[model samples]
Target: MDLTLAQEAGGSSLLSLLPFLIILLLFVPLFLNGRKQRRQMQETQAMQSALEDGDVVITTSGLRGTIVDASYEDTIDLEIADGVVTTWLRVAIREKVAPDTTSEDDSADSSGSTGTSESKPTIH
Candidate 1:
């Protein structure tokens, strides 16, 4: 029953490695998720640093504004409303808001052809 004892030893070896394999499986996804998050953060930082005047953006807190000035080292002037400019940290800017791509005719058509037009005031 020397053969039986050898078979039992091999089974035990496999069982001993089971816990290590489970732990490895658990850590792999966490490692990959962290790497992905770090890469995204880097991309966000790059976007923030490259911001310029007139670029509309949204903040982390859901405030939408236009970039009035980006000359400061760590802060930016965000005009949230006409004559209502606010200063914010550059890092607070979440993402640049894309301009509406529809043409004026398409927009007018969608609005049911309102004869009146309202011009938005600039922050200056």
Candidate 2:
């Protein structure tokens, strides 16, 4: 008539917390996902803002280029390698490349054909 009352009180007290605990469990992932998404968006924005002229960049299409311009409207002009210029949306840039790094050695090829036929038959 004394110790039994304390045990019964403890058991009933824990029941009230069950629903709150379940709600917390369900919301945890959703909260974490939202925070992660927000961080990703901020990172994207920072990357976009850092774009500058002469900065080599890779587009989402796997195309590589140097950034000729970046606009607030979320678009940029890319100078692909040398002499190939193209316009792209800011979101299309997947990565940035250092401007000084280039595989095409300027000394090895001087005025070479850019994948286009320039041969003209000699008229005898």
The regions of model 2 sitting more than 4 angstroms off are: 98-124
Using TM-score as the measure, the top candidate is 1
Quote the positional error of residue 98 for candidate 2 in Å: 4.7
The lDDT for every candidate, in the order shown, is 0.91, 0.79
- TM-score, every prediction: 0.82, 0.64
lDDT of 1 by residue, 53-109 (tens): 999899999999989999999999999988899999999999997777335646866
Question: Against the true structure, whose lDDT is highest?
Answer: 1
Tens digits of per-residue lDDT for model 2 on 1-124? 8899999899888988899999999999999999999998889778877888878788878987777777657788988756777888888887776544455555434557577756658743
Residue 44 of model 1 has an lDDT of 100
Residue pairs with colliding backbones in model 2 are none
Q: How far is 74's C-alpha from truth in model 1 (Å)?
A: 0.4
Model 2 scores a TM of: 0.64
